[model samples]
Target: MSETTSKYKAPALERGLDILELLSEQDEAISKKDMVAKLGRSVNELYRMLAILEARGYITTEPESGKYRLTLKMFELSNKFPPMQRLLNAAGTEMAKLSEKTQQSCHLSVLHDAEMVVIAVQDSPYKMGFCIRLSARIDVHGSGSGFAMLAFQPEDQRRAILEASETPEPVIESVLSQMDKVRQKGYFIGASPQISGVTNISYPIFNSNRQVEAVLTMPFLTLNSDSLHHQVVSFEESRLAVADAADNLIHAIGGCTPE
Candidate 1:
């Protein structure tokens, strides 16, 4: 928490938020006992908050297991925010077009607290394709989208993001070198660190102030010889297509790319 935020405390609200955050991080619904142990709060203390959250439709309890899990309410609420809504509207058409053209899956990601959160995704119009789930959190040092956005940030802002990263110093140094290459090329094309045989191509989307607002990434997959949907465009063509889609989104939002 920041100093400014700490000055005003709302204990009840904090407990509610803490519960939500903890649930969001879990892969499966968690029991109240586990929640109490993880949050360091008594079951009595969290009981009312959990009930309120469940009542408000932010979370739900499984009837069989009696465990708590998040609902789609938060994601739906976030989509209603005007700025995020606008970004989605601008990217939707272009992202679809890019996926259709390249026959590959693509996603748009924005920086959030030193991580990249996937906001929108478009699956390829092919029988076999890859798609990342919405709201997926990606490591800043491990994704091409992260490098594309970080490489274009102003020196001070870039330094701040790097300073906030938990990556080891040696790995950070190596990532910095890659970012330099991304800056020189004005985009990123690299093998994915998390998945094998998939190349990542990413371009930075800028706002009116010439600051990077998001990154558009295409996870290019090579088709097997027996696959029905063979690659239509060359690798360079798909990369350029992703760049064009990013540019189109910027134009749609009345934004600009830096010279």
Candidate 2:
């Protein structure tokens, strides 16, 4: 907690938020007993907070297990926020077009603190395609989309993110070198370090002030030769399509590339 946050205290609100945060990190529903243990709070104190959250539809109870889990309410609320809404509106059509043109899934990500978060994604039109889930958090120094966004940031901001990274020093140095190349090439195209047989193509989307606003990424997957759709999009084609989609989204959002 920051000094400013500590200065102004709201015990009830903090408890509620803590519960929400805990639930968000959990992959399975948690019982009230588990929540109490995890939060280190007494059952008496959490009962009301849980009831309020459940009543407000921010959380729901699993009928059979009688455990609590988060609902989609928070995600829905985030999409209604103005800036995110604008970004989504601008990128939605272009992302769809990119997928249709490249026959590969595409996603839009923005930097949030030291990490990148997928805010929007468009699945490929084909039955077999690579798709990243919305709201997935990605390592800032470990992805093509991360490099694309970081390559264009103001030097001080980039340095700050690098300083906060937990990656090994040697890996961070390599990523820095890769970011320089991304700046020179105006995009990134490489095999994914996390997955086999997948190529990542990414472009930085800039705002009107020529600041990177987001990264548009296509995880290109080569389809099997025996598949019904034998037409394979070449690497060059996917790169061009992704670049064009990034350009279109920037235009739609009234953004401009650095001169």
* Candidate 1 Cα outliers beyond 4 Å, as residue runs: 1-9, 27-30, 62-67, 224-231
Candidate No. with top TM-score: 2
Model 2 agreement with the true structure over 77-144: per-residue lDDT tens digits: 98898766788998888888888887789999999868899999999998888889988999988888
Best by lDDT: 1
- Alpha-carbon deviation at 12 in model 2, angstroms: 2.2
Q: Clashes in each model (backbone N, CA, C under 3 Å)?
A: 0, 0
- Across 48-116, the per-residue lDDT of candidate 1 in tens digits comes to 999999999999999999999999999899889876787899888999999889889999999998889
Q: What is the lDDT of candidate 2?
A: 0.86
Residue 136 of model 1 has an lDDT of: 93
